[model samples]
Target: MKKIIAFAGSNSSKSINYELVKYTVSLVDDFDIQLLNMANMPFPLFSEDDERKYGYKNSLVELKEDFDEADGVILSVNEHNGNPSAYFKNLIDWISRLERKFLEDKYVFLMGTSAGKRGALGAISVTENMLPRFGAKVENVFSLPEFNMNFSAKTNTITNSNMEKEHRKQLDDFLGKLIKK
Candidate 1:
């Protein structure tokens, strides 16, 4: 079975991005999905001084291994004032140090979700521009705004039918791209 890693870009224990990612992962077929928590892969704030002081964080190694071994990745980022959450950005920074092109030629579905109107659009744009530079294929992208209003966590369903339909199309498109690669 093809293995995929799913994760959110937020450290909040109750992150809406995490909820959306889990929901998206559950809908995937014919893939072995592993959900990872940003909190579990903690890293020091990115800085030359920190790197010199504590060396590489263990979480970095674990994350690198997961990314290296996975055939694909599904990521849903949480926005903080129109940018990626600090924790997620820190993880990216550290990982880049270890492998400048960790996502090179990799299949990735970059997405984001939020309770606001923009639905983490800001973070999505930034990542879309940046991840490719790091060699991420970034096969597809989506944003779910007002996530709490559109998705029912307990039931694991998208409450709005139209949005769900559109998202399903995008997800199917992403899967097709991955399979073809």
Candidate 2:
């Protein structure tokens, strides 16, 4: 079976992006999906000094192996100060140091969400722009805004009908690409 890697960039215990990823992966039926929670996998605040002092981490090598084995990735990033959260950025920094262009042409569905009206669009934008540099195709993108109002925690799904349609469409489109190859 084809494998899909799904993860939220946030490490918060109550991350809405994680909820979004759970709901998204539940919609898939054909592939073997692996859901990774960054919250449980702790990393040091990345710095040049740390890499120089400690060298590569075993966890990052394992992470790169997962990326290499997967056919696609579903990634939802959390926003902080109109950018991808520093925690997620730190993960990228450490992983990229392990190997350049580590994503290696995987099809990626980039997503984000927030309590505010902009849906964490800024973070989504930055991630989308940069993933290609890491060899991610970034095949689709979605942002859910006013997460509390648009998403239902009780039901674990999107509550707004219009947003639901677009959300499914994006998933379908990304799936189509994965299936075609």
Candidate 3:
């Protein structure tokens, strides 16, 4: 089975993006999905001083190895002021330090969700534009808008049929590519 890393790009205990990630990963029929927690990672702000002081933890190195070991990635991001949550960005900063093109040649299913109608479209757009610089081969993207109304975290499923179908199609496309590799 292809191993995929699924994670929400937020540190919040009750992140909507985490719910979306769970929902999205459910559509995958034959993959071993490992859910990663941002809250578990401990690192300071991205600075040369911090880098030198910490010298990268074993967890950070292991996290990078997780990415390197995966066949693909499923990312659900949280939006903060039309950008990725600070915790996610900080993770990216640390990851890039280990490898400039951290996502190079890796298949990524980029997605985001928010409480508003736009979902996390803003953050998705930002990631789409910039992640390629770090070698993100983002093949598909999805955004869930008005998350509170359309999705229920307790159920761990998308409520709207149309939205659910759309999400499935995106996941199928990504998985299709991943399996072909």
The most accurate candidate by lDDT is 2
Query: Candidate 2 vs candidate 3: which has greater lDDT?
Result: 2
Task: Check candidate 3 and list the clashing pairs.
Answer: 103-135
TM-scores of the candidates are 0.95, 0.97, 0.95
Give the local distance difference test score of model 3.
Answer: 0.86
The ten-residue window of minimal lDDT in model 3 covers 36-45
Model 2, 75-175: lDDT tens per residue? Answer: 99999999999999999988888877888878999899999999999999999998888899997999999999999999999999999999999999999
Tell me the whole-model lDDT of each prediction, alpha carbons only: 0.86, 0.93, 0.86
**What are the C-alpha RMSDs, in order, of all predicted structures?**
1.2, 0.9, 1.2
Cα RMSD, model 2:
0.9
Q: What are the runs in model 3 whose C-alpha is more than 4 Å off?
A: none
Best by TM-score: 2
User: What order do you get sorting by lDDT, best first?
Assistant: 2, 3, 1
Where does candidate 1 clash, by residue pair?
none
Which stretches of model 2 miss by more than 4 angstroms? none
